[model samples]
Target chain A: MSAAGGLPRTGSALAIWPALRRSGLGPGLLMLAVVTGLNIALQPDFFSGASLSGNIATFAPTILICVAQAVIVLSRELDLSLGAGVSLINCVMASLPQDKVGGPLGVMAIAILVAILLGAVNGLLVAYAGLPSLVATFATGAIWFGLALTIMPQPGGVISDAIGDRYAGTLMGIPVPLLIIAVAMTGWAILARHRSGRRIMAVGSNPQAARDAGIPLRRTKLLAYLVAWILVALGAIAISAQTLSGDPRLGTSYTLASVAAVVIGGISLGGGRGTPWGALVGALVLGLVTNVIYFAGIASSWQEFVKGLVIVAALGFMVLEGQRRA
Target chain B: MAFTRRGFTSAGLGLASVAALGGIKPSQAAAPVTIGLSNGYFGTEWRDQMIDASKTQFAMYENQGLAHKLIVQQAGPDTAAQIQDVRNMIRSRVNVLMIDANSATALTGVIHEAKRAGIPVIAFDQAVTDPYAINVGIDEYDWGKHYAEWIVAQLKGQGRVAVMDGVPGHPAAVARRTAFMDVFAKNPGIKIVWSGYGMWDQAKAQAVMATVLAATPHIDAVCTEDGMGLGIMRAFQAAGRPVPIMTGEAQKSFLLAWKKERDAGHDVHLFARSNPPEIGRTAVGVAVRIAAGRKLKPLPDNTYHYPIKVEVTNDNLDQLLASVADKPDGYFLGEYLSESELDKLFV
Candidate 1:
């Protein structure tokens, strides 16, 4: 998948297969394929319009969050605050008066701006203030959550039906959620092509070396956070569209889920060695695992245990593949 | 794909045969229905009891051949995951869907999808705002009002009362809080000293109550929702302060604690109402009847209010304790209506 990002193509399919297998995305792709097959086998109506759209919409927020987390992870920084940031942004968007400045569109713009500001705060704390990303984001995550609670103490704010309808609806025969995923991927592709993106990877892979080589470590890290949070903002918007409402606690699950997705995608936890596409596949795999469990008629008492087992097994598989390659 | 087609045809034929079998029984006009229950937030003992009661009710129906299956999908506090759960149930072609929703409004879209697919949704516990879904739960406002009125009466409408609420922004908690505030507002002499969220957990309630106890002086009584009364009493006990008059819930731990307090001559006055986990059982009964082509009487705002059945006070604490003697400390006291009692709601 990373090879698709403007890497010169080897003419032969056989050449591409080994190259794909050698990349960090290999294990995630394998898991995704297996889960997709399992899901299709379990539910024959998986491609029916209602089922397809519902599945895509449900998977989209997680996918976007994974991509967002991937960007931060790629820069050797982790933002635990992304989920809380999403919650705060969702609350802000929903709480905005529909009759006010430019209505839903304006609210959306403001939400994006809020996301960037939140990213900048995390970035500033981690990069400029020299605080560890984990500690900084963890503290900021609490503050964001508190602010979200203050904005909407309980979950009851209305978003426009237009957003939800379009989100759940297809445009020109393509599902809106699929389009959202496409847009995020395209955005990542563009970012990957830019110099700042290379600097981020450099900083992640070897910060001291990158600094000695004249790269601005702090700026690169901050840029990665900004880019990542824009994706987070998009994810929050997607969530608002799905729920058609705001919830202060809505993004609670995504925090840890995104990190898990990053790991499942075979992304290196310590630094850069993965693609956002890998994260997308990883998110889908996780979502489909739940689907598979439900369709398999697993007892409710065993669902959580089974889900954990599957994830652990997938991670173990990735680790084994990595070791085999080494 | 061919195998799937053959399997689908056989499944259809099996259902047809079941319908043919049901046709012989005049009382069972409709075929047995498969009920799907989607529960969000299964962290509490109350939810476990709810699911257990639901399964027991489902078994009763299955025994009478009124229900074919009960498919339950339970998960934590993720609305998106719960939506997926509902979708899975819909795809599996469950005749009806019962939900204890994570959010009041977040589920509207999927609920609408379920409606479009000809699936009726019955929301219990935390009801969704969607009009298409039938809400079957206790009147949360009344529950709160009952507790508040008791507190006001015991305090003679005058005292510093510290209020401990359940999850902040939770629908039921919000409604109950409104009731508490409204009841307290009517009596100006009753001053609310401190109010904070306990998040509907015993430990959290205890922790928050400890903070309130340390920060404030002379809290005449504590008004709190269910699942937290024992924790509140524990906080007071840990502080070595007298357990003041307080509102409690119909859980075994609290009742046992209250009994212990009375036995110790602590002069504890209490009022507790059952937020019965058996509401899920009631909802199961309703869903089965609805699936069997029972016509429901026209409901206002599409909500069927399950009557609150039990309340414990100083007068009846011992009796309730004796009844639940074999139950565990985490046991919640609850009851569901009989089939005959449920029949009154339908035409």
Candidate 2:
């Protein structure tokens, strides 16, 4: 790396901005813009205040889960258990007796605490026990799902109509979920600016160099997972507010969804470079795709097929965009 | 075919909520009030029809000085979210809440909360068992018993029978299954070889039927209390097995398939009954009335059992449902919502 006008320059003019072209987040943002714009065009009324607000509201949960996946990936790790983490939270929160269910703060604390504990188990298995993160989290995810099944076999509990209404409601003229996401992203950007965070990124980009540089590899790996778990827990909270109920199967589809979102955003499956905005944009793309397909009046059966096609196109775009610069 | 069983009403209606809780006294001088409604499941057409009838009935009430707003939902079939929606409605202080519960027990607490919030609740399709939640749906036990009786009749009083049940432990499934077995106690000629749990998935039921056919050599008849289980016929068709006699209620498609099977010399009968959506909407109406301060009785029979009108074959299914679907105004708290009934001023 060499500095040109205080900015790193390399390769060709394209390589001069290689970070922009190589950056996974850029294509992901493009996908988001396409999906959102297409949605607006497809259903003129889809841009109505309530509908647009709902778009933002629904995106929060999926974005959170994707970001969680992104963080884990950035640490040369994966946590397939995130969707299961969300499912577990749903069962736990809904199982709370309606009368006995405490306030939002209490329920949120317990949900996050349980999720972190589950995450720690994943960390211990992968970082200390030397099991691969993929297999470890996959197994733990199954166990978590089983636990959710045992906790609330059927949906119940009255999520404080108040909390859901408050958080899901628009503030002034914007969907509150969007506001929350903005706040979360800024905080994440600040964290990414720190030295430890840079080390995590370096560790993701090149594990050998990170090790040679004497990074506390296992601890860094463990913290990445913890952060991921926290995001998964937050995703469940957003979903809970949206649905106002805890459905065991509610989080079932989100596992593949989060992975799809991150990958679509140009995040590498092999683990390395990615960004928070990439995950957010990826989720918005998928969500908009769903809305568009349904608005197109396609049958329910077609939904799966259409989404599958979108994922393929997204991957191709990401790879092409990456190679054109390379 | 005449449909001349003039829709009439008896005085024994829900007197528990409105009259007792409502502070206002009815002097019979007000316009009908409009009530907003929302529900789930679009795959169920009978439910849609039932809702249509409920709206007609509600309109008739408005003609007689009462009204309603219908808004059903399809939220990915997520029940907890639906419950949360209802909770929000209660907080918004809807006069009364009527629900065709997805979970028999799970909704009990929400029903109770609505009641505590000064909104009466009516559990129409599925009972909640909450003391405050009044039950108004079919007598699922009787529903099961009737299905068994029909199956026995199809077998000419005896055969090897099996149950393709709904979701395990579902209130309807339990009631229908238990009533069927209880009814079978008297018909010694019928032997139940296996009870397959299909979870109300059509494809799953078809598969279950295939598995049952493979294992049970003497299975002569198959019965399911839910309309979705008729997939057994499709299962039998696919496997080319001797189609066992099949039965269920209120699905036109099933009845059409049943008629096809019967016409082609297969043994399948339709225990033609109605979906619970009507009961669901009516439960809401009753709750609203309670909140409005009208007097009501402790719902007739403690649990209102919609009549068991069996449409023996295709012709009968059409005939039965036509009467159900084309009523001037569907069955209301007391009678058919007639034009005169429909003529009452707006609420």
Candidate 3:
């Protein structure tokens, strides 16, 4: 699929297919198409207003986290703390004193700052302190989780209606979830066009070479983490809006699931590969798998087994395609 | 992956039949009611049995042509996912919505939306505090209190008791912990030496119990919320200590384990009560009735407490054990009201 990279584009509708396939998004798109087709066939009304919106809304947090993880993964680093960061932000948002200035908005502004600070801490540990990303983030994840539990011992605090409605409502026939997806994609596109983006890829590809070539390795990596945390904070906000309540454990699943989504999106765990678009498709594929399993009347006992098998098979397919390309 | 042509044909036929059924006016006035069960968490064996029992009841109703099949959508432990599961069920226009809520308050907004959509929602197993929905479950606080009373009596009102709780801050966990703590306070002799949260999983309970055992050298009794008692027992066995006077739930595995311990000449005094899985079936029945325009006798708090099945002690252990001898390990040893039995609650 990468063969289309050096070829001149005809700039036609026919050319878009090969271009998408060349970006390593091909396998993810295929999986999404097949799974979504199966879902629509089984439920028939799967694309109807409420069902479609709910599907996207439920999976939007995962999509946002996927991109966040992609940012880190593209730098040959991992941030296991993103999930806990999201959880901490969610709890903080909910537990914001009702009498505080500006109420939820003030709480949200504070949360965004906290997210950036959390990201900066991670960046310092990995880039400045020279700690291995895995162990560093894991420890930070526990710290963040403990902080979240401390902030909201129970999952009971409320988010104001203004913020909740803004996240959950539709606009001009488009679901809020779709809007969130658009924002993430657009944000990534802008980042990819910037110089720091190229530096991140360079660092991931060969850090020593990039350093010798005069790139600021530490700052570029830190920038990637900063951007990733911003997305994660948005993810936390999305989760807060959807549930309209605070949970200390709200984002626990996202930690590993985001990584799973990144790999499934055709991104290499070794890093410096794949696109954010692929991550988007990968998240949608995972979401549809659950819906298809339910609507197809797969027995409850076998549901988890089937889901695992499908994911493994898709991963295998991606591997084979990668090998064929080489 | 099993998207076969015949499956598609049958699905089309099913839709056509549903549409045909929707179009017709039955002289007998039977409406093909669709009930949706949105279960939030599947971490426990109790949930498996609960879903199994509900499905069995739905099948029985379908066989009798009382309703269409129940649409069951199970999600992970995430609150947002479960809320979306409820929304998806609503989108399908299920006549009734039944939930085993992940949180008491997290899904309130979504439940309100379901009610606004003309769907009658019944919260069972995990009752929500939402006023609009029909709440059904065991009185968790009383369940804890009764067991605590038994433990206090077994200890003759004085002992170093260790308490094992379920997920901290969970509504049922909170109620159970409060009731047990209250009961312990009432009995001046009952001193809780160590307390730990077990999250209601067997392995988690076992690990927590091991830690508690390490910290406090001696315990007169172990008071554990059900589902995790078996694990706590395992911790005792692993440590090679005599099993203390313990409170267990009505899980078949625990009953069998208790009997085995008894047969092995271990002097163990245990009491277990029903936190029955059959409540799922009861909730399904209630949802069906409410959707059919039947008026239910309203309780002041909008909550209906189903009867506890059995409280097993040494005297009654043999009978309870024999009743579930042929059942699976995960089965809960309790009874729920049959369909006709549930009918009396309605006007």
The per-model lDDT (C-alpha) reads 0.84, 0.65, 0.81
Which is the leading candidate under lDDT? Answer: 1
TM-score-better candidate, 1 vs 3? 1
User: Model 2, range A162-206, lDDT digits (tens) per residue?
Assistant: 657667577877677887777667767877898777777877889
By DockQ rank, best first, the candidates go 1, 3, 2
Native contacts kept (model 1): 0.73
Those runs of model 3 whose alpha carbons end farther than 4 Å from true positions after fitting are: A1-14, A99-101, A300-307, B1-27, B214-217, B237-241, B261-267
Predicted structure 2, TM vs. truth: 0.64
lDDT agreement of model 2 with the native? 0.65
The candidate with the higher TM-score, 1 or 2, is 1
For model 3, which pairs clash?
A1-A22
Off by over 4 Å in 1: A1-17, A317-326, B1-31, B214-217
Scored against the true structure, residue A256 in model 3 reaches a CA lDDT of: 75
lDDT of 1 by residue, A1-34 (tens): 3434444556775566656654577777878898
Which of the two candidates, 2 or 3, achieves a greater lDDT against the reference? 3
List model 3 lDDT by residue over A167-227, tens digit each.
Answer: 6688887888789779888988887888888888888878899999999999988998998
The C-alpha local distance difference test score for the whole of candidate 3 amounts to 0.81
| Candidate 2: stretches off by over 4 Å | A1-19, A34-55, A98-102, A124-139, A165-183, A216-218, A288-310, B1-145, B148-161, B168-194, B210-221, B227-246, B249-310, B313-347
Candidate 1 local lDDT, B136-237, one digit each (tens): 999999889999999999999899999989977888998999999999999999999999889888888999899889988799999998889988999999
